[model samples]
Target: MQATNTLPLDMVYHWEATKADSLYLTQPVGNDQVVEYTWGRAVDEARRMASYLKSLNLPEKSRIGLISKNCAHWIMTDWTIWMAGHISVPLYPTLNAETVNYILNHAECDVLFVGKLDDWEMMKPGVPDSVRCISFPLSPPNDFETWDDIIARCSPLEENVQREPEELATIVYTSGSTGKPKGVMLTFLNMAYAAEGGMEVLKVGSDERMLSYLPLAHVFERTFVELASLYAGFHLFFAESLDTFVEDMQRAQPTLFLSVPRLWVKFQQGVLQKLPQKKLDTLLKIPVVNKLIKKKILKGLGLDKVKLAGSGSAPLAGDVLDWYRNLGLELLEGYGMSENFAYSHINKPGRSRTGYVGENMPGVETKISPEGEILIKSPATMLGYYKDEEKTKETFTEDGFLKTGDVGEIDEAGRLRITGRMKEIFKTSKGKYIAPAPIENQLMANQSIEQVCVSGANQTQPFALVQLAEGVRDKVADEAYRKELETTFSQLVDRVNKTVDPHEQLAFIVVMSDEWTIENNFLTPTLKLKRNVVEDTYEGKINDWYAQRKKVIWQ
Candidate 1:
C-alpha cells in the first residue's frame, strides 16, 4: 500500500488538477434544498476563505476555533485554516457555555468560526472579546463576519501555501466521559498516515459515497469524512438534521457507513419493531424467505447499498454484530483513540472475529503491557497533549508506546478484545474485583435495555442501573408493559449471572424511566455513556433498589 506524503492542502490541489469538475460535497439545508459543490468550486471557496484569513494578519500557526454541526462550510473552514498556515480547533456543537469557554481559553484561539448551531444565546457568553468571530451559513447571533460576505469581499489566494508533514494540523479535544476534556495535538503527518493506512485496508474509491453526520470534532468522523475523503477523493454528503436522517441516507445511498455502537443497537431495535425477533428468527430459518427478508430489512434501513459498515467509539455487542451479519452486512468493529488519530486496529473485509477489534493496521504495532494495558506504536501517534506536558508524558511509556488505559489481551491471531478500563474496574467490599464492560455488553443484548452502568463501590456485589429503550419507556405505567419488562429483565439478569462468577453476580437490575441523552449530560457527543455520571446519579438509589425483594427494580 502506498503511503501519503503530501499535506491535505496539496491533496486538494491534486484533486482539483485531476478531477476538477467532479462533485465533491452535497449539503442539504431544507426539505428540497441542497447546495452542491464540485471539487473545483470547493477548492476555489476554500482559497477565498484562506485569502480572507490571511488578510487578518494573524500570527502564523494561530489557533482558529470552529464550532458547527457537520456541513460543507465546516470542512471548507478547516481547509481554509490549514491553507492559511493556522491550526484548527474544532468544538462540539452540543457543548455547554462553560465548556466552550474552557476550550476557547485553553486553546487560545485567535479566531472563532461559527456555523449552523442550535443555541447561540447559550454559547454567546463564552465567546471572549479578544477572539475575532467569523460566521458560516445559518449565521449565529452576534457581530461576527458572515462567510458569504468574506468570500465575496476577498480575492482567491493565488500563491500556494506549502506545509510540511510534521506541521501542526489540528487540536482535537477529547470528549472525556469522566473529567475535563484535554486537547490532543495532531500533525499533518499523523492524519495522513492514518488516512493512508485506513485506505489501504478499506480500499475505498473516488466513487464511494459517505454520509457525514457524526461530529467532525471527534477524530473518528474527522479521519474518515475529512482526512480520508481528501486522500480517497470520495464524494461526501451531509445530513440535514436528525429528523431527516433516513431520507438523507436514502438519497446518499452511501457505499461506506460508520457509526457508533449505540446507533447500531437502535437500528437493531428499529428492525425488531417491525419484525418481532421471534418471527424474524423463524423466517430466517426458512430457505428462500431468509434471502428476501434480509433484502427487505437492509433496504428499509437504507443500508442495502453499503459495501462496508463499521462500528466504533464504543464496544458493540456480539449479538448485534451477529444480527447484522445474518442480514448480510458485515458490521466490522474497529478500535482506536484520539491520541492516535483513530488509526490502530480494524477488522479486515473477509477476516473478522466476532468479539474482537481486529489486528493492527499497516505501519502499526500493538502489544499488551505487563500491567495488561493495551499499548500502541504507530506513525499516527499524536505529538502530545496540547497544553499539559505532564499529562502527555504520563500517557506514553519509557519505550515510546502510548498507554491506551484499556485492559485487554491479544489473541494468538493478534486480535484485541477489550476487557475493561483500568479506572472503571471496581472492587467489592468482599475484596472481589468486577469488570463491568463485559457485563454491560451482555446486558445491552437485552432488547429492553438502552444503556447501563454496573457498579458496587463498597457493596458485597455489583448491581446494574439500566435505562430502558425508548419504545419501552413510552408505555411505562401500563400493567402489561410493566409485567413484560419485569419478566424480560429478570430472565436477562439470571442468564447473565449464570455466565459470570458468583462474586460478580448482580444483586439487582434497576431500570430508569428517563432517557440518557447528550443534552442531558448522560452521554458524550459521540453517544458513549458517561458511566461516572450514571453511577453518581443513581448511587443514592442503589441501596433502596437492593432492599427490595424483587430481582428487578424500576425507578
Candidate 2:
C-alpha cells in the first residue's frame, strides 16, 4: 500500500511467488489469435533466458539492446536482462538503421534482442555484427537464435538474484524531436520510485487491466505502464497492430488507459465521423438519451470500461480533454520527460484542471527558473545522460533540480501550465518572439487540422504548415470539399489569430499534401513534430508559401 523502495526485478519475483497462477500478459498474435502468459510461466521463461544470458559470459552490467514493439516477450526479455545482472537498453522500434546503429554502438551493447516490429528489414542492418542477436516469437524471419529454442534447451535459474537499488537498470534513448537521441541512464531505484509512487497515487489494483500499445522505449510508457504494472500486479495486454487496435482494446477491456494528444484527437474525430459534432452536442443536452449515447460512443471506441484514463507525451487541447470528460471518463494529463523517469507531475482525479498538468508529485519538487524554464527534482530522476557528462551537467542546476527545458508557470493552485518549449520559441523579423504551441493548440480545435508546425524565424510574421486530418485529406480532391476546407481553415486562422498578440498572430495556414510520419522523418517516434526536420524539408517552399499571401494556401 505504501510507496515501494523495491526494485522492478524484486516485484517480478514477488508476483511470481504470490500471483503465480494469475494471468499477467496477453499478447495478440496476428489473425485474432492471442498468447497468454501467467506469472509463473513468464518468470520461468525469463529465468531460462537469464540462464542462457549467463552462459554467454558477458561482463557485469553489460548493456543489452532491446528493439521491439510492445510485446509480452519484450517485458520478459527486460526481466531476463536484469535477472542476469545486466543493463537493458530499449530502442524505439521505428528507428532507422543509422540511428539504431548509433545507439547500439554508442551504448556498446553486447547483445541485441529483436522482437515484434513492423520495420525489421530496415533496422536489421543497424545491429552490430559483433553483438549476438536473439529473436522473439513474433520477430520476423532472421538467422538469429530464437527465444523458444533457448528456453527449450536451458533450465530456469534457481537462484533468486537481487539487484542493488542503485545498480543501473536501463538506458532509454530520447525520441530525438530536436536532434540525435541521448541515452538516459536510469537505476533500479529510479524505476521503483516512479512506478510505486504512481501505482499508489493512481490506486491501481491487482485486478486492473491495461493495454500497452505505446512504444515501451519511451520513458512515459516504460515507467507508468510497464514498470507500474510490475508493482501493482495488473494484467497487461499488448496491441498487435494498428488495424486491430479497436478489437485489441475490446479484448483487453482495460480498466486503465493511456494515450497521447494526437491519438486522443483522432479518437474524437472518429466519433465525429459517425455522429457529427453538432448532433452529438444536441444529443448530450437531452438527459436520458445523453447517458445512453455517451455509453454507446465509448463502447464503440472500446474504452467504455476504462476508469483511470490518462493523456500525456504532449499537451492535449483543453476542449479534447473536456470532450472525453463529458462521456464520464476521468481523464488526467501528466507531465514528465526521459531525464526524470517520467515521474514529474500528474493531474489528480478530482483536482484536475484542463490546460494544466497538475501539481508536483508526492516526493517531487518544481520551480520555474528566472528564464521561465520549469525545473524539477524527483526521486525518479535519472543518474545522467550515458557517456555525456558535459551535457548532463548542463541539464541540471547547482541545487540539483533537472532543467526540464519546458517553459511553464505554476498557478495559484500549484498546477503547471506549459507555455512553450524554450528551444522551440522563434522570433519574427520584427524581433517579436512567438510561442507556437498555444496557437497550434488553438488551430487544432478545428477537426480538419491533423498536425500543425508554426515557424517563421526571420519572416515578417509567423505562418503555420498543417497536415489535414485523415478523412479530410481523402476529400481534398473534390472541388466542393476543397472549397469548404479552405473556408473552414480561413475562419480557423482568424479565430486563432484573435487569441494571440498581433505579432504572434499567424499570417496564413498552408495545408500540406503529405502526412507527417515517423517513416518520413517529419515526426519523432513518440509522434512529436521534429521541427528542424519539418522546417528544413520545406525551407525552399516557405518563400513561395508567403508570396502566395492567401489566408489558406494549399500545397
Candidate 3:
C-alpha cells in the first residue's frame, strides 16, 4: 500500500524494465484491423514523439494542447508532453469552437496535437494561426505534421528525462456545467498520490484489463485509465467506436469496468428488452435458475469477467445498484471532483454501502462544513486554478481543505451520501426548499425515464422534465407500449411521492422527446446534466406543464 513516489515518466520506465514485452495498448482500426503496442514499443514511440516535440524549440514548461477521443495516441501524446518538459492541456472532443479557442488561448498553448475527431470542420475554426498543430493517427484533413511522419523522421530520445514530483504536470479544465471551464493546475505529485491511493484500495494487478471509452479529458478517466495503468501496469483496451463497444468489451473481457449511470441504465434496459423485468425477477428467485440467468445476462452485456464494476461522475440511484447486485454484479458508487484528481472516496468491494460513496481514500481527509458542504484535504488536491487566484482562493477553505461544492453528510461509519449540489436546491413559491437530486434519483428508478431534471423555483410544487430512454420513441407509436409506459410511470410516481415529504412531491412529469447529449450542450463531457441550462431552456414552458391536469404530459 506504499505510494509510488515517482513521476509518471519514471513509472513508465519501471514498467519498461519489468514488463518490457507485455502488451500495453490495444487500438482497433478498421472492421478487422487492430494495432497493438508492447511496453517497449510504446516507450520507444513516446520517446520519438518527445524528440519531435523537443525539436520545436519551445520554451521550458510550454503548454501543449491535446484534442481527441480516448485512444492509444492520446496517451502517447500525454507521455510525450510530460517527457518533453511541457504541460498538457486536454480538450473535450465534443467542445464547440468558441470553448476550444478559449481554452487554448487562455492556456497560452504553443502546440496542439489533434487525433481522431468526429467533426473536424466544426473544430477547425477554433485553431489559432499562431499555435502550431500536429496530427495523430487517423487524423482529419489539416495542414499539420502527422504522427507517423514525426516518428519516422525524428530520432528517439537517448537518455532518461525526469521531473520533480512537485513540478506542474497538466492543466485539466472543468466540464463547464456551472459556467466557463476553468483550468485546474495539477502537479505530478497530485496525480501520483491519487493513483497510489486508488490502487491501494482497489488492489489491481498487472494482469487486470480495462476498456477505455470515456472522455480522457475528464479527470475520472485520466486517473483510472492512464495514471492507474502506469502505476499498476494494467493492459488498456480502446473501443473502435460506439458501434464496436460490445465487441471490444467481449474481446477484452476486462476485469475492471467503470462507467457512468446513464450507460448502466441503458444496459439494464437492453436486458429488459430481451427478457421482461417480471420474468427475470421470477427466475432470479430460484437458486439454480438465478445463477444461469446472471451468467447469461452478464455475458450478453460483456461483463461476465468484470470482478470490479463502478458507477461515478453522478449520483446512482439505490434501485439501480440493487438491480445490478440482484444479477450478481456489485456496482460500486464513488464520489470525487476534477479539483482532486478523483481521489476522494470509493465503496470498497464486498463492503459497499447501498446509498453512500464509501470511506475516504487512503491518505485523504474529509470533513463536513457548517453549511453541509463536503471538504477534503488530500495529497491529490490540485495546486490551484491556473491564472485565477481569486477563484482558487474562493474554492478552498482558509485552513486548506478543498471545497467540494457538494452538499452531503457522513454517516457514523464514515460513508458519504451526496444529497445535492449547494446551488441546485430550489425554493418554491410556497416557501419550501427542495433538493432535486434525491427526487431525481427516485424517478430514475422507472425504466422509462432516461434523465430527469426537477425544478419549480417560484412555483407552488416542483415538477419533473423527463427524457425517455432510447428506443422508447420507436415503441411509442404502438398502443400497447404507450399504455404500458403510462401505467408504469403513473404507478412509479405515486410510489415515489408517498416516500418523500408532501411538499417535495412532483406536480407533474413533462415527457420530452428531445435527447440530451454532450454535443448539444445539455450534458457535460462526463455525462452530468447541466441543470442551469436545462432550467433555462424550459423555464418558459413550466406554466403550461403545471396547468396540465394529467400527471404525465408529453411535449
lDDT of 1: 0.90
lDDT of each: 0.90, 0.91, 0.90
- After superposition, the stretches of candidate 3 with alpha carbons farther than 4 Å from their true spots are 1-4
Candidate 2 structure quality by residue, lDDT tens digits, 270-387: 9898899999999999988999999999999889998899989998888889989988987899999999998989999999998999988778999999999999998789999999
RMSD of each: 1.2, 1.2, 1.3
Output the TM-score of candidate 2. Answer: 0.98
RMSD of 2: 1.2
> Which portions of model 1 miss their true places by more than 4 Å?
1-4
Find the candidate with the highest lDDT and give its number: 2
Per-residue CA lDDT of candidate 1, range 1-555, in tens?
A: 344587788889999899989999999979569999999999899999999989889988999999999999998899899989999999999899999999999999999999989877888789898999999876566677898888988899987788888999999999999888999999999998998888888988888999999999999999977888899999999999888999999989999999999999988998887789999999999998989999999998989999999999989989999989989999999999999999899988788998899999999888889888999999899999998999999999999999999999888888889999988889999998888999999999988788888889889889988887777778778999899878888999899999999999999888887779999999999999898898888778777777886788878
Off by over 4 Å in 2: 1-4
Clashing pairs in 2: none
Model 1, position 231: C-alpha lDDT score: 92
Number of clashing residue pairs in every model?
Answer: 0, 0, 0
